[model samples]
Target: MKKNYYYIAILAFVFVFSSCKKMLEEEAENFVSPSQFYKNEAQCVAALNGCHNPLTSIFNQGLILANEGVTDLAFLNNQNNETRFELSPANPGMGKGLWTSAYQGIMYCNAAIQGIKGAPIAENRKPALIAEAVVLRALYYYVLTSTFGDVPFYTDDVANLATLEKVNALGRMSASDTRKFLIAELKAYVDALPKLRTSEVPNNRISSSMANVLIAKLAMWEKDYGTALAALNEVKTIYGALAQYPLEDTYFRNKNKPESIFEVQYTWSVSGLKKTTQVACYFTPPRTANTSTYNGINIPELGDKANPFTSVSPSAYFMSLYHVWDPRRNIILAYTYNGQNFTRPQSGNGTGKPWMGAKFWCPGMDNLADGNNQKVFRYADVLLLMAECANELDDVALAMSSINEVKRRASQASSASINLELTSYPGKVEFFREVREERARELMGEYGRKWDLVRWGIWYESIMNTVANEFVDIKQNVRPYHEYYPIPDNEILRSDGKLHNNAYK
Candidate 1:
């Protein structure tokens, strides 16, 4: 089997950094010894850049499929077995890719942290760099724990090939322990990071606001509403006057707009060192050659050619939840086919149905790569999260204000009846339900659906009612174990029995 490109690059760096002087001197090949490499700031910065490369593949594919494909909002359309909740310990696509990418990213971060500490950089510059690496490591751990439950957690870099095998022997950390570690680590970094996005390190780099957002997400996952609210309030204070970060309708364009709090940066220009996103190819509709059409519709050409893989389709239940005039409906549901506005097919199997969410579509892009930055956190997401925290705290007034901010933005784009009034939802339960629905409407296909459902304690029941109904096979095939994906069989084998699958699985 061929080695993953990311693994090859990161492993090569590890050998360079940790290899002994005798090995470097005896070897006739090119190798930059750690002592020589850490003598300058440029090398340290280059090492930091390597840490971010794995995230490009994570956001472009693995994270999106794992989070969205199993949810009611969408399912993988490329005959991905994981979409049907048929994931197994040996499922390479769903389990192996994510596990490997996240851990490899963590290794790069650890190497960066160690290298930067010894580098002869400015005294004041060290804290921010170290903090950024720490926060990034926290993010990788958070993703791993969320998806696979318990995973082997480590902070030190694997010093040699032998050390790599020893590191694999470590046992998995408990989920609660992983969450506590992430929260504590994030809190420690918040003070060291820049309070706001700056010209030097914009939204793409980890800032205090981004750190707080991660804190809020972790807190919310644990249902610790008070902690989540505090972190969100800190984010609000940093951004200043929620009005400063109003929702932008064209937020999806790759301009790095003000609405973004944290986004993974990608570039169109290819280089040996640079990384790009593949969303435009995976999410955009295929076009035919004879006519500028898609699925028999004369739509304007978006991608260069019609590929075997197409956009992930929205579920019928998800499409039905929106009102006809809702502005988001137009943004998310409408797709042009044969010169007609087609949102849902008139007749067909519900699972295979096609619809477009314009947020991820990018016109005029090379094959499988686009410059559009993948949004990890946005101002709208923060507000909706605030609403959820406030609702849990029984602060109905705050909750209403928080959620209405998002609705207010949606109402402006189109005359869609998407407005929500305080009077319409009299009770807290009713209001919270609408808040959930609002999040689904605003964040569909953006990779928040499964986590939202899981946190709401409605993942199983919601699926049993919605998508499972249309595809009866789903209900029969799914089990409680399906909630979290199983650890890949290869990971288990590599661990030498030190790690085990989630107990529920």
Candidate 2:
């Protein structure tokens, strides 16, 4: 695999889209000051692209060995199992790398929001631009707080040595307060912002509806079911129909289907660096990583030859949660070749046979520039959010219908979904639990699991149980302090512990 030296051009905001690599691999000499760029409209918007770029990184390919799609190590690996990463804080394993990488993205979003707001863009363009910056920043904070407990929050720029002190004074903010602030901030802009972004939209950028779906998502994750329902209802009113084509045809195995509320756009090629979505390059099969021979099987440039990418396989315990007869069961996972035989192992580890949880499909024969948009928040999630909200109010019928709707579409059925019901014992709490577990299975491998657990209040318990056997592994050890990430060491040392006032500390 190649190193990420080329990222110096995007070091500030691109933290969210690409994977983690050593600073040694990046040329320190190439670092550019913000003052040198982000001077005007075009430059500011370019800066926004850098902010959104990291979305792809954190979701699919940032920390290679620690697949974000495969485990919520922050909770699952460290909370329930006898995992070492949870026991050892300084362990050079994947969990710490993921922890560090996610925070780096938060830092990038913070910098972009601050830089764009302070830039000299015209007043006429400033509100929308500021809105975009805030939306992205809120997104960064959302992902950060969801993964690590008390991530230091920043709404300003901290560029120089003396300025970095502000960060040290902060500790973890209450997750509840953090969620409320972010959700409100995003809701305020979704309908008011422009439908289409002036810069990039179909390729590595976000739009108003994208913000809408995300707000809905943020609401759902925060367990504000009523608010989440209201938010997604707004989205459905504006952009929910899939009449142009069957929802399933556009969704399921095909990437960038019309129902996509928001996505990470990619234009990859085997040649010199392009504004390609690095995600596909990082997760496709090893055979597709360097070749251009297989586009016919998947959706984008279906038969084009392509290179293969490596990834951690899905957990065996989770895999058993599926219903064998479901069509999407096969479509969502590649346990057997051609949907029947066991997948051959890409690595020989006991559970390490190659198994792809189908979400993104790279065209085999096409170059990296196949233009496949990675759907970030699709209608399906909105539907689920709505259903969850319905369940919260004991509207079992609506909840069942909503889940069934998503399932039916995944199964390519034209009529509403069938066999929907929550058979759990009594109360809404039990039903809510069932809804969440179902989502875990239905929405696996999409970087939403950890947040789901946290929002449901099982994050602490899960991590504690997971790391019970790893008493020596500091990384696996779940400290009450860990509910919020530690303030970055640099920021703490600089702040003299005064500015933000140690949140988790």
Candidate 3:
């Protein structure tokens, strides 16, 4: 079996950093090599598409996600099992995968910046492309700081293996400092990004509105309530309310919509030299959704026998996140081979099982079918963030309204419709908890939850309580440094024993 490339991406980090300067410099000097790319506009777009390529394949899409999911909240939500990060705390491929993927995202962004910078695009188009690159680079930096407090910063975007290695060698930047840099980059560049996008490119790049969303996010992280609210209001004013889509209509309703600020795209194709959308299909039940070898699932060949470890089954705790009456509960967690709650396109009649994590919306396809996009950021997020920001600012009316907008959409057809539009919000601490619950309910299974808790400075505490109070996992991993993941051991070794242990350790 092959190793997890997500881990390889991080393990390679120290080596990449050490050798990056010489690596890129020593290579051929043309923008992108004639051997591979750099032909024209389409190629440039394709290369940008390539920048988002990593999120599709890492750990075979076994991404339970980070911040709150693996730490304590939902996603895989296991404790005491051998593979459980919540129990074991660290070092496994699972926990490390989160750390690695974000770094790889940064690496990809770096390459795109370098490639586009040297591309021979017209001057007017250049700013738009550059804005995409800047926003992407900043997003990665934001991840770097969020996941591991002090991380190496690389404004010198270059594609050379050596250039990458050199940046990797530099190690980390202060989290507080990096957040400020991310703030400035988005402010300076996000507005120029193209607003028009299709599924193919929509989730693959950032937008002006996405920049505003990012600003709101960073401001919240910085505890700059004033700035955060201001930024969020801008998103509200510019984007208008999230165009209403009944939350229960279909899994794909609001997704891939224009309301999407940013998302990750996946494609399943055979000759995937540029990108591979294999994982989601690999995990899809063979009998249904044209995933079977016999069905000619529109994919490249899987590894003869499939990689089945990637199949998802929710944690018991995850199932408990929703009330028994909550409509989304069954759609998300509990499953049946053939039932209303279970996923569809199940082959082999109703007998074919529908496991958890049908959220990606990329079921059976050929080995290389591009899975539907994953919305990393959206207008709905703005509403939720604004609610939190309003709560922080003590504007109960606005806070409730912000939360209600998301709730109204989420509960459009349900027995409950969260109507905060007219009601007052609870106190700061109370609204804070409500916001967390709303995020968990609305954004469940997405990558945002765990980190949202972390940013609130309540991750470790909440996880500790949730485990002890809810799941009975008295041994849930809780440590100060849990707020910031450890700098991978290999990278720290480069400090020549001078590296201090993370607060958690």
Q: What is the TM-score of each candidate against the true structure?
A: 0.86, 0.68, 0.72
Best by lDDT, which number? 1
Q: Per-residue CA lDDT of candidate 1, range 260-319, in tens?
A: 677776655434323456665556555665444555555454544434255666777787
Model 3 off-target regions past 4 Å? 1-47, 57-72, 75-83, 86-108, 111-121, 158-171, 195-204, 248-255, 269-326, 335-362, 365-372, 415-422, 468-480, 495-500
lDDT of 2 by residue, 1-505 (tens): 0123223323543332222221111211212466565577766666555555455555444332232342432212223221233323323233344444555555666666676677777767766766776777776676666655555565655555444445545665676677777878787766546674222343424567667666666776666677777766676666544333353433323645556655554444567434444445444444433333232132344444554444344445455555655554544555543433442542365344334534445554244433455544666667777778888867777777776666655445423344333443346676666666567556554556656665666755654543333333433444544433333444443445442324333
The alpha-carbon lDDT assigned to residue 144 of candidate 2 equals 65
Which is the leading candidate under TM-score?
A: 1
Candidate 1 TM-score over all chains jointly: 0.86
Q: What clash count does candidate 3 reach?
A: 40
**Candidate 3 lDDT, tens digit per residue, 313-362?**
33445555565445555455435322333334255674343354344335
Q: Once superposed on the true structure, which residue ranges of model 1 sit more than 4 Å away at CA?
A: 1-10, 14-31, 160-166, 198-203, 240-251, 269-278, 296-310, 335-340, 343-354, 416-418, 502-505
Judge candidate 3 at residue 470 and give its lDDT.
38
Q: Considering TM-score, which of the candidate structures 1 and 3 is the better prediction for this target?
A: 1
Better of 2 and 3 by lDDT: 3
